[model samples]
Target: MPERASARRSSRSFAAFDWLSVLVAVLQPDGSVQYANAALEQMLGVSRRTLVGSDFSQYFTDPSLIQSAVAGTHSHDFAAVRFEAVLRRLHQDGIPVHVNLGVGELREHLVVELWPLEQQVRQDREERLLEQSQAHKELIRNLAHEIKNPLGGIRGAAQLLELELQSPELAEYTDVIVHEADRLQTLVDRLLAPHRHPHEVGDVNIHEVCERVRSLVLVEHPLGLKVLRDYDTSIPEFRGDRAQLIQAVLNIVQNAAQALAPRMAQGDACITLRTRVARQVTFGRQRYKLALELHVIDNGPGVPDAILDRIFYPLVSGREGGSGLGLTLAQTFVQQHHGLVECESVPGRTDFRILLPLP
Candidate 1:
């Protein structure tokens, strides 16, 4: 009767850990799982009943790492030791996690905690990107406003100079000044474009946006480029600005076409428009139950490693004579919809993915 009561007391004590978000487990000195929390079961993609009494160390990439940690308890060492290890899931690839092992005084059982290291690193990167976006917005707005009026004055002065100059040499210099001023004006307008318009929110069908961009791109590049569509038709309409999304996607496609000029001449260029539903997605520091993943993929030389990280920043481009505002504008529009644009590239493939919440 006393042993049964002790087991009942242990069961109740173990139940207290079921609600934790972190994966927690109580293990014996020999590495057998005495109790597995709900989070641990979820992480392992298995049932608590099956997880308990199993050799917990077997689920890790290096089982000896876990066994060694458990062996520390035999020496009466209670200090938590931390190490990084890979946890093997039932149906998924192993995920890198930071493990903490220490013996709890209450039951003298080893308490093990496992948290995904990837999660913390991803969160840190997102935070840095958010901070960079805010800084870029402030810098662009201030710089554009500062340069706008002077550009007007310079253009006007050059016109006056052209009228006064009788010599062809002086007139050519005035033309150059006027042309450069006009170019600067156009750039300033693009820099301030995001702040000028109010974001119009309405029902948006992602496929419709994709078709519009596809048609526009095909019209521009009629000869060698083929635009293909692979869309998930079940994606529901979401609340967003339709025109902004169209423009954002269009910019990405246009950039790809421009980069594919070499392959286009060879008659082998292709751009694919793909969309699907993403569940439990986290980006821009917020988690969504569902999000739409729209990809603009192209077969071209990838983004230069030198400027890949800053492609979304103002005036950064990998191509010659490229204005570099396309990606910046696309990123701004997506951000207005509470989404983010990310890119992955290799030698012959480049994918620009835009993530937006779905209704």
Candidate 2:
């Protein structure tokens, strides 16, 4: 009974690593695989059963490099080691990876993580995106307030001028002024919307929010766009503002729907709402143990490179006749929940991912 219970506890401990974004393994002192995470399983194109009890060093191009690294830890001074190497993948060419090996709580096992070479670049980009978004929110809020007072004053002056027009035909000039002022007023209101709302926090089921947006978008474009659900229901609920999340996800989904307008004509448009739980994700200079990953992916021509970087900025819209506040509002809402949104696009696929901390 004691042995079985200990085995169960170890199994539970390693299960958490299965959802991490990077490949992870618990290696025996000799570099045999004690456990292989889901990410590693997928990367190596092998099942956990095949990976466990195998010599982990053999998977790398230079087996002696890893064997010596494992052997060097016996000196007792080393806590961690990092190196760049090529990892051999099943049925694929060798992949360039940054390998990080660290001492685990149990000295008998070492915790090793394999990060794709691209991960560092992606992480740097994410950090920059977070910083830029912060700067944008502050600048936009101040700018919007500065524009608001003058806007109201201009509209009032125009209305008063229209009432005193000596030649009534000249009222057309005042009318144009008032019309443009109203449009600008609406824009300013949206810019301030995220700041104005009080967060009503509660336990949030992300799938519920995705379903709400899916139904709404489907209603708007019922016959043409297919809104598919790819959800991991095992994810636990977290504390958040349900309404704000709904709005955040809705805006992203709506943006994708509009982008898919061209594909809709041929009845092949698709927008996928994919949800998964990510473990040990780091962004905004903080590391989170677990996070909920929600992706709003569309089959479209992709975001224009000209405006792709500025999509989160207020008043930048990729679509013609768009108010451009949808994505800005979405970014603000997600950031309020201590999360970040990222985008990756190619000619046929545009994926917008929202990452929020999970309990």
Candidate 3:
């Protein structure tokens, strides 16, 4: 009995140490915060006095999430529930956040850990997108100025030479040059399309965007794959460019569908569209009150780890015959709206997440 008591005390001490290691730790009962760790205070830029005894929901854009967490802990038969909430830091702009909240009974209070879905991932994606967009813009400008003019001159000269030729074989060779120039023109136009198009910004319903993408995908791969919707109807419309968002989401879903092509013969291939409201996500060096979490999840062998990190880089592709600018263009469109995009892939699953700020 004495040894068992000692072991229990040791476990309790270790639990306390474990909590200290987390980025943020909170204790709540009846939706009020009873305790918070130093890291929690540091993360929020607030003092413990300002946190304790306060309703944790006050910081969240959706207070109902706390109620959901409390109810989740009571039933063992219930599946684990995940929720997204934005919490306000002491800063002027409340940081938009995405948390995978789970509840556990800790003594008399509920212990919860708040995970920042878009924070760690957001910063890196934004940097890459900015760099990639600039690089593409420069390349397009240079190509048009340096390459297009020269190609046009060459094609024009070839046409003149063909007209002057008495030999039919010589004319045929000139025709090839003109055809190649036409092909180059098409390639240049495709590379410039996203930047050249004017953004039409307005209120955008995320579900509408997903449905549009689903319809388009079905037209091509109708019988081969299942495109499913796992939506959170509670998500609100945000100020965004509707046409751009549609293209952004479409590109990702299309890529996922293409990835499943190889595995189509094996079994049922699936792509799921999921959305939820996330409060307080940091994007482009600023935090917003409400953000949307849209996910394109697919069941395939998964993106290989070797090139996964550079998947967003232009000209990087995992499939043969892929132009490789699909994801890069998608990332550019999302970032222009002050949002971020990220991907997580492993065996049996590949997920692409788009985090856009709500108005």
Candidate 4:
């Protein structure tokens, strides 16, 4: 082959390669920028020209952490190290970015894959939550079946026993059994409702859904809890189960509202509904064409730490005398539509992100 022909083929192969993946990239030794994907560009709000020649550490909040990751990665035999460091994107914006650094010698240069730290964490969290939700569903089904028959027989026997007793105090004890059995039945019905009913899918305007939830929640609270909407007007319609999605979103927002009960009494409660379009989102180990990001943010005392990890588990509740199936059912419906649900909580702010795959 001629020299010119060989060089042309090599150029074509390099051009076809996907260098910028879902994470950030910073060249080692000099810490120069090789390339960043659309995700980084959108995140930093900067052009390729400005970022190409500069050091990526300048954008991070802690330059030392990046240096440590780089040195630690190179000192070993190309082992990856995880770091939780915030990026000082600009003067005003400091976004918390988790990064995993790994060094690979490629074409005589040490290339570092700046894996955006949250992607992996979010995936693991979603998988665990899904498993918990499914397990809850299975447990509920079995428990309901097992308990219903026995409760029926007990209630009947109690009625017959009540007749035989004739003592007022003994009859009251039978009434207690009947009342408790009825309550259990009602609880089981609520748990099985989603699986029993078929979801109605159609083109849904997300703004309308937010508006409906906003009105409903505001009407219920009516005083301290403020429901604010921050919707993207350019967001297009997608195929979704309108009623189910409404209920899912409503559940999350309502939970936030309930969390704000104390804050509301103190005039510090505010709930925000934020919407944006996300392209090429991966969910359930599969990438989607498009995804809708809906965030429910609250300015209140965050979720209790005791139940934080198990919030999606059935019967796990933060509130007194509350059933903890809201987040679980919300997750199930979202996952059914090929999406992911995520939560970030702290002392004053709690955000629940719902990512629904687009049509």
**Model 3 spans > 4 angstroms off:** 1-50, 53-129, 132-136, 166-168
| Model 1 TM | 0.80
| Candidate 2 runs further than 4 Å off | 1-59, 64-83, 88-116
Ranking by lDDT: 2, 1, 3, 4
Q: In angstroms, how far off is 312's CA in candidate 4?
A: 1.2
**Candidate 3 structure, TM-score to reference:** 0.66
| Predicted structure 4: clash tally | 2
29-141 in candidate 2: lDDT tens per residue? 77788888877886677788888779988888888877776777645546666777667786455544554434342556778887776666777788888888889889989
User: Which ten-residue region of model 1 has the weakest summed lDDT?
Assistant: 97-106
What's the CA error at residue 321 for candidate 1, in Å? 0.2
Clashing pairs in 1: none
> lDDT tens string, model 1, 1-359?
99767855776788877755457888866778878877677667778778777998888878887777777654556455677787888744555445443334335678887766666676677678778988999999999999997999999999998899899988999999999999899999999999999989889999999999999998999989999999999999989999999999999999999999999999999999999998655688876668899999999999999998788988899999998899999998999999999998998999999999887
Q: lDDT of each prediction vs. the true structure?
A: 0.84, 0.85, 0.75, 0.75
> TM-score for all predictions?
0.80, 0.77, 0.66, 0.73
When summed lDDT is taken over every stretch of 10 residues in candidate 3, the lowest stretch is 14-23
Residue 119: error of model 1 in Å?
4.3
Clashing pairs in 2: none
Mind giving the per-residue lDDT tens digits that candidate 3 earns over 1-359?
99667644634543452234244444544667666665566567777677766777666777777667666664433444556667667464675556555667756556777666654565666666567767866776677567667887888999999889999988899999999999887766666777688888788888999999999998988776889999999887777889989998999998999899877666588999999887545656656657789999999889889879878777778998887878887887898888778899998899999988787
